[model samples]
Target: MNVSNLCVLTVTVICMVLAWSEPSKACGSCTCSNGVVMSCPNIVQISLRSSGLTNLSGSAFQNNKIVTNIDLYGNQLVHLPAGLFKATTKLQTLNLRYNLLVDLPDGLFKATTELQTLDLDDNPLVHLPAELFNATTKLENLYLSRVQLDYLPAGLFDAITRIKVMYFWGNKFDHLHAGLFKATTELESLYFVRNQLVDLPDGLFKATTKLETLDLKENQLVHLPVGLFNATTKLRKL
Candidate 1:
C-alpha cells in the first residue's frame, strides 16, 4: 500500500477502537423485562419515571458512577436507601415528585454536591433533616411545594447561598422564623401561597434584595409588619 493509503487505514482502526471503548449513548442503559430492570447501563442519564416502582433494588445504580440526571417521579417509593447516590457525585438534576416519602435520612444528599435542581413536590414529607441540603452549594432551583411542611429548622437554608427560585405553596405553616432566607441573597422568586400564615416578621425580606416576585396569596395574613418590603425595592409582584 502507498504511504497515504496506509496512514488512512491506521487512522480508521484507531477510530473504531475508541468508539467501541466508549459507553453507549444510543439509549438509556436499562434492560427491562415486563417493567423491571434486569440490567442497567452505565450512562449519563437514567430515567425510570412512572414505572410503577414501589421500591428500588439496592443494586439499581450499583456500578454506574457517572450519572448526571435521574428521574424517579410518580413512583410509590416510601424511602430511599442510604448511599443510593454516593457514587453518582456528578449528578446535577434529580426529580422525585409525587412520591410517598414522609422523611429522608440524615445526610441523604451529602454526596450530590454537584446537584443544581431538585424536585420534591407533591410528597407527604412533613419535615427535613437539619442541614440535609448543606452539601448542595451549587443548587439553584428547589421545588418543595405541597410537601406538608409546617416549619423549617433554623439555618436550614444557610448553605444554599446560590438558590434563586423556591416553592413553598400549599403547606401548613402558620409562622416563619426570622432569617429563614438570610443566605439566599440572589433569590428572584418565592412562593408562599395557600399556607396558614397569620403574620410576617418585619424585614423578612431584608436579605432577598434582588427578589422580583413574592406570592402571599391565599394565606391568613391580617396585617403586614411595618416596612416589610423596605429592602425589596425591586419587587414587581405580590
Candidate 2:
C-alpha cells in the first residue's frame, strides 16, 4: 500500500481499539440477559448507560476495579451496595443520573477520593447522608437536580474544592444555609431552579468570587439576598 493508505489504516486501527477499551461495568451478572462481559478492561472509563439492563448486581464491577470513570445513567438499579466501589476507589467521575436509586448508602463515595464529577440527577434520592462525599476533595461538578432532596446536609460541600458547577434544581429546599457556598470559592455556575427556597443569604457570592452564573428560576424565592452580587466582579448570568 502507498504511504497515505498505510497511515490511514493505522489511524483506523487506533480508533477501533478505543471503541472497545471501556468495558461494560454497569449491569454485571444481571438477569436481564444483556450478555456476558467476559473481560473487564483496564481502560480509563466505562459507560453502560441506558443499556436496558433490568437487574443491577454488584458483581458487574468485580473485574474492572481499576477504571476511573463509570457511567451508569438510566439503569434499573434500585439500591447501591455498600462498599460496591471500595475496589474502584481510584475512580474519578461517576455518572448515576436517571437511575432508579431511591436512597444512597453511607460511605458510597468515601472510597473514591479521586472522584471529581458526580452526577446524581433525575433519581429518587430523598436525603443525602453527610458523609456521602466524605473525602472527595478533587470533586468539580456535582449534579443533584430533579431529586427528592428536602434538605441539604450541612458541610456537605466542604471536601469538594475544585467544584466549578453545581446543579440542584427541582428540589424542596425552603432554606439555604449561609455556609453552603462558603467553601466553594472556585465555583462558576450554580443552577437551583424549580426549588422551594424563599431567600438567599447576603454576600453569599463573596466567597464565590469566581461565580459567573446563578440560575434560580421557577423557585419559590420571594426575594433575592442583599449583597448577593456584592463580591461578584465577573458576573455573567443570573
Candidate 3:
C-alpha cells in the first residue's frame, strides 16, 4: 500500500481501539425493575430487599462501585463474597437485614473500615465471628436483632468501644459472655428483648456506668444478677 494510505489506516485503527475501550462494567449498585434488577450508575444506595434475588453471584457490582449502602432484605442468599466490598472502600453503611446469611468471612468488612453503622437483623446466624467488628472501630450503631443466636463469644467487640446503640432483640440467647461488654463501658442504650436468658452474669453492668437505657422486656429472665446496675448509677428509668 502507499505510505499515505497506510498512515490513514493506522489512525483509523487507533481511533477505533480507543472508542471500544470503555471501562468494564464489572459491578455497580442496582435497582429492581418490574420484579427484576437493572444496573444503574452513580447510585450511592441500593435497595434490593425483598426482591427475591436468591442467587446474587453473577453480579458485576464492581464497576462503578461507589456504593455506601446495600440492602439484601428478605432473600434466600446464604453466602457473600469475602471481598465483596473491598472495591467500595469508601462505603460507610451496610444493611443485610432479614436475609439468610449463615456466616461471614473474617476479613469480610476490613475494607470498609470507615463503616459506622451496620444492620444484620432477622437472619439465621447461629454463630458470629468474635472479631466480626474488629476493623470497624468507628462503628456507632450495630443491629443484630431477631437472629437465632444462643450464645455470644467472649470479648467479641473488644476493639470497638465507640458503639452507642446496640440491639439484640428476638433471639434464642440463653447465656452471654460477661467479658463481651468490657470495651462497651461507653455504651448508652442496649436491648435484650424477647430472649431466653434466665439470669445475667454477676458483673453484667459493672463497667457500663454510663448506661442510660436497658430494655429487657419479654425475656425469659427470672432475676437480674447482683450489682448488675451498680456501676450504672445513672439509671434513671427502666
Candidate 4:
C-alpha cells in the first residue's frame, strides 16, 4: 500500500477505536440505551449487576440525579464513595447484594431519603455505622442477611419508623439489644434464622406489635423469654 493510503487507514482505525471507547456524554460510565444516551435524560433505573466492578468513582451517577432504582448486585465492590448517591435523592430501591463490601460510609444514603428497599445481603460487612440509616427515614424493606454481623449499634433503625420487613438471617449475632426494634412499630416480618443468639431480650419485640412472622430457626437459643410475644398480638408464625 502507498504511504499516504496507509497513514489514512491508521488514522481512521484510531478514530473508530476512540469513538467506541469514549463514554456516553450523558450517562458517564454507566450503560445506557443508544437512544437514551443521545437524549441524555429520562434515565430512571440503573442496573449493573454482575459487572465485575471493583470500585466506583463518586461522580459515577452524578448526571442521573432523578434515578429511582439502582441495582449493583453480584459485583466485586469493596467500598462505595461516601457521596456516591448524593444526587440520587429520588432513589427508592438500592440492591448491593452479593458483593464484597466490608463496611459503608456513615452518610452513604443521606440524600436517598426516598429509599424504601435496601439490600445488603451476602457481603462481608463487619460493622455498620449507628447513623447509617438516619436519613433513610422512608425505608421499609431491609435485607441484611449473611453480612457477618455480630452486633448492631443501638439506635441503628431509629429513623426507619416505617420499616416493615427485615431479614437478619445467617449472621454471627449472639445477642441483640433490648430496644433494637423500639422504633419498628410498623414491622410485620422479622427473620433471625441461622444466627448464634442464645437468648433474646424479653422486650425485643415489645414495640413490634404489628409483627406477623418471626423466624428464629437455626439459632442457639436454649429457652424463650417469658412474655416474649406479649405485645406481638398480630404475630401468627414463629
Candidate 5:
C-alpha cells in the first residue's frame, strides 16, 4: 500500500480501538479509575449500590457532564460534599436511598437543572434546605419517605412546578403548609402515610387540580376541612 493509504488505515484503526474501549471501561462500574466516576463521554448510568461507600469527594463526578442516572443506594454515606454533581448538568435520576445521610448541603443540585427523579428514601435526614431543589425545575418524582423529617419549609417545592409523584411517608410532620402543593399542579400521587399529622388546612389541594391518589392513612388527623379536596377533582383515593 502507498504511504498515504497506510496512514489513513492507521488512523481508522486507532479510532475504532478508542470507540470500543470507552464503553468497555465504563459499562459496569461507577468509576473508571482512582475513584473518579464516569469519566467516559458515552457513559450515562452509574450504579454503585451497597458498595460500602462512606464518603465521596466533591470532584467525584467532575467529568460526568452528560451522565443521566446515578444509583448509590444502600451505602454508609453520612454526608456529601458540595458541588459533587456540578458537572452532571444533564443528570436526570439520582437514587441515594438507604444511606446514613443526616442532612444535605445547600445548592448541591444547582447545576443539575435537568434532574427529573430524586430518591432520598430511608435516610436519616432530619432537615432539607428550602432551596435544595431550586435549580432542578424539571424534577418530577421526589422520594423522601422515612427520612425522619418533622417539618418542611414553605415554598420548598415552588420551583418544581411540574412535579408529579411525591412520597412523604414515615415522617414526623404534625402539619403541612396550606400552599405546599400549590405549584405542583400536575401532582398525581401523594403519599403522606405514617406521619404525625393532626389536621389538614383548607385549600391544601386547591392548586393540585390533577391530584389523583392521596394516601393520608395512619396519621393523627381528627377531622377534614370543609373543602380540602374541592379542587382535587381527579382524586380517586384518600
Candidate 6:
C-alpha cells in the first residue's frame, strides 16, 4: 500500500475506536432534579459521599452493570427505590453508612451476590427483612453499628455462612435469640459493644466455634449463661 493511503487508514481506525469508547457516565450525586439517569457501563467504583441526597429513583443503578464498589456515606436517603441495585450484579463493596434509612426492600442485595463487605452503620434501620443477606454468601464483613436494630428474624444469617467479621455495636437489642449465629460458624471477630443486651441464651455461641475475638463491652449483662463460650474454644479476647 502507498504511504499516504496507509496513514489515512490508521487515522480512520483511530477515529472509529474513539467514537466507540464514550466517556463513562459516572455521576457523583443522585439528586437529579432534571430527571437525569445514572448509567455508567465501565465504571468500577462510585463515591457519592455527603451529596445531600434525600431519595434515589428506582433506576438509579440501572445500566450500571460493571460497578464493583459504591460508597454513599452521609447522605440523607430515607428510602431507596426498589430494584435500585438490580443491575449492579458485580458489586462487591457497599457502604451506606450515616443515611436515614429505616428499612430496606427485601432482596435488595439479591443481585449483588458477590458482595464481600457491607457497611450499614448509623442508619435507623428498625427492621432487616429476612433473607436480606441470603444472596450475599461471600460477605466477609458486616457493620451495623449505631443502627436501631431491635430484633432480627430467625435464619437472617442462614445464607451468609462465610462471614468473618461482624459489628453490632450501639444498638437497642436487649436479648439475642438462640441459634442466631448457627450458620456463621466461620465467624472470627464479633463486636457487640455498647448494646442494651441483658443476657445471652445458653449455647448462643455454639455455632461460632471458630470465634477468635468477642467484644461484649458496654452491655447491661447481669450474668452470662454458663457454657455460653465453651464451644468457642479458640476465643482469645472477650
Which regions of candidate 2 are displaced past 4 Å? 1-41
TM-scores of the models, in the order given: 0.83, 0.80, 0.77, 0.84, 0.86, 0.84
Q: Candidate 3 local accuracy as lDDT? A: 0.70
Model 6 alpha-carbon drift over 4 Å, by segment: 1-39
Tens digits of per-residue lDDT for model 2 on 1-238?
A: 2223322332333234455553343223222112222243444566666754445444445444667888777876778877667767779889999887889988877678888889999998888888777688899899999888889887888778789999998988888777887889999999989998888877666688898998988877778766678887878998
Error of 5 at 197 (Å): 0.4
TM accuracy, model 4 = 0.84
TM-score head-to-head 3 vs 6, winner: 6
TM-score of 2: 0.80
Relative to the true structure, candidate 5 has a C-alpha RMSD (angstroms) of 9.2
Model 2, poorest ten-residue lDDT window? Answer: 29-38
Q: Count the backbone clashes (under 3 Å) in each candidate.
A: 1, 1, 6, 0, 0, 0
Task: Give all candidates' CA lDDT scores.
Answer: 0.78, 0.73, 0.70, 0.83, 0.83, 0.80
Error of 3 at 157 (Å): 1.0
Off by over 4 Å in 4: 1-39
lDDT tens digits, residue span 109-176, model 5: 99989999999999999989999989999999999999999999999999999999999999999999
Output the better candidate (3/4) by lDDT.
4
Best-performing candidate as measured by TM-score: 5
Candidate 2 local lDDT, residue 88: 77
Q: How do the residues 1-238 of candidate 3 rate in per-residue lDDT, one tens digit apiece?
A: 2223322332333334334543243232333333223444445555555655445432324532566776666767687777667666667788888788888777787777778789999888888887777888888889999888887888788877888889999998888777778898778899999998888888877777888888988877888776688799877657
Q: Which stretches of candidate 1 lie over 4 Å from their true place?
A: 1-42
Candidate 5: residue 2 lDDT (0-100): 27
Please write out the lDDT profile of model 4 over residues 1-238, one tens digit for every residue.
2223322332333334334554343224333332122222455666766766777767566666777888888988998999989988999999999999999998999999999999999999999999999999999999999999999999999999999999999999999999999999999999999999999988898999999999999999997889999999998999
What is candidate 1's lDDT per residue for 67-179, written digit by digit as tens?
78888888788887767787778899999999999988887788999999999999999889878999999999999999999988888889999999999989999998778
RMSD of each: 10.8, 9.4, 11.7, 9.0, 9.2, 10.5
